[model samples]
Target: MIPPAFDYHAPQTLEEALSLLDEYGDDAKILSGGHSLIPMMKLRLAQPEHIVDINALTELEYIREENGVIYIGGLTREVALEESDIIHARLPLVSEVLPLIADPQVRNLATIGGNLAHGDPGNDHPAVMLALGATIVAQGPEGKRSIHINDFFEDFYMTALEPEEILTEIQIPVPPQGSGGSYKKLERKVGDYAVAGVAAQVTVDGSGACTSAGLALTNVHYIPFKVTDGEDVLVGSKLDKEAIEKAAGIASEQCDPSNDLRGSVEYKRAMVLELTRRALRDAANQARG
Candidate 1:
């Protein structure tokens, strides 16, 4: 499929990219890795008059740690996150599932910023970020600001980003000592989007009691959901079968499933319960260490 004709600009600096976005407004689309957007353009769902590519903007291509937060440059590729030694020790969830995203070639070209900004509920990172309590760091003509992952997705295929705004980084707080995290997804096939997925992160005390917990689900709703019962059940208690079952029930109740190629509401609902258990179990294994 051929995409519609558009003016292309590979901007070396953010300022140049922002200027182009300002000029084109809603008619302009920013290109990071081009995995998602280019495909949408080819399908004619997105018809931008101008394309501002920022792959050459080296300023926005790094992963750094400062203070208590780990800042992943918006332009950082998924492959780098999978291979990051720093992330392995700091956020093991990122290390664990980064490779599970699409395939190797796509990972090398897909950017974290693009994935988050595109706001696809089926994508892996949104729910993961929500579970990690991360923030989207963005820039606009008005200057820079941060938005919580909860508020980032406004609706289906919609985001909190303004017309002139550009996502610059994803900031996640480093977990304290004895923190463990895991992400589990069920795809029909290797490259298929998840039928349902879970991201679980927890902080444990010396006695093996959960001090804090975060749980997020994907492919169950228009936006990713943070499962309160699932998280609350683990905190202040040792994760067990009973706790997981109760939490999974709550998480399943929270989902709004629909019939699709994946399955029916009844099946997807079952997945919410089943996947939650696996995710919680995986998280518990890490917590035990």
Candidate 2:
């Protein structure tokens, strides 16, 4: 499959890229890793007249922690996240998700910014970010602004990013002492998208009571589904069998999974229930340490 003819612009700097986006507006598409856009173009699902490639924007390829937050440059590759010590130590949920995204070749070229900005529900990062309560930074002609993960995804294949803006960074608060996170996914095969996945992050007090919790679902709804009800059920609880079962039930009930190749609607919901239980239990155990 061949993408339609388009003028390609490899910008030497972010400013040049923004200028091109401002000039072209709706007619242009920003190309980051090209993993997502290229396939869409080839299938004729996307037909932008201009391609603004930002692969040369080296300034946007980094992973660092500042103050109480971990900042991941939007252009940082999945492979980098998979190997990042900072991610492993500070953001265990993200670390867990990186390896499960796809095969090594795809991860090598898939950028975090591209993955988030693309707004695909099947993309693992959205739900993980939701569970981590991360922030997304976008740059446009007016300058930079931050969007909370809660407000980032507006609809199916849609995000809060304006057409002229480029995602620059992802900001995640450092989990406090005694905090831990995990991701549990049900996939048909190694490279397949999750049939149903859950991300769980929990902070436990000395007594092993959950002080705070975040739960989110992937590949189950029109958008990344944050299981706030499940979180509510877990917080203040010891994450006992009863609490975990209750939260799992809430997640399975609240999610709106569609029937597809993965399984029937009932099966996906069942996976959500079981995966939610495992993820929360694992996260709580990690937090207890």
TM for every model, in the order presented, reads: 0.96, 0.98
lDDT winner among the candidates? 2
lDDT of 1 by residue, 102-206 (tens): 999999899999989998888889989988999998898878999998789898878999979999999999998888888888889896788998898888888
Off by over 4 Å in 1: none
Q: What C-alpha lDDT values do all the predictions have? A: 0.88, 0.94
> For residues 1-289, what per-residue lDDT tens digits would candidate 2 score against the true structure?
9999999999999999999999999999989989889999999999999999999998999999999999999999999999899989889899999889989999998999999999999999999999999999999999999999999999999999998999999999999999989999899999789999999999999888999999999999999999998899899999999999999999999999999988999999999999999999899889988
RMSD (CA, Å), candidate 1 to true, equals: 1.2
Worst-scoring 10-residue span by lDDT in model 1: 222-231
User: Scored by Cα lDDT, where does model 2 land?
Assistant: 0.94
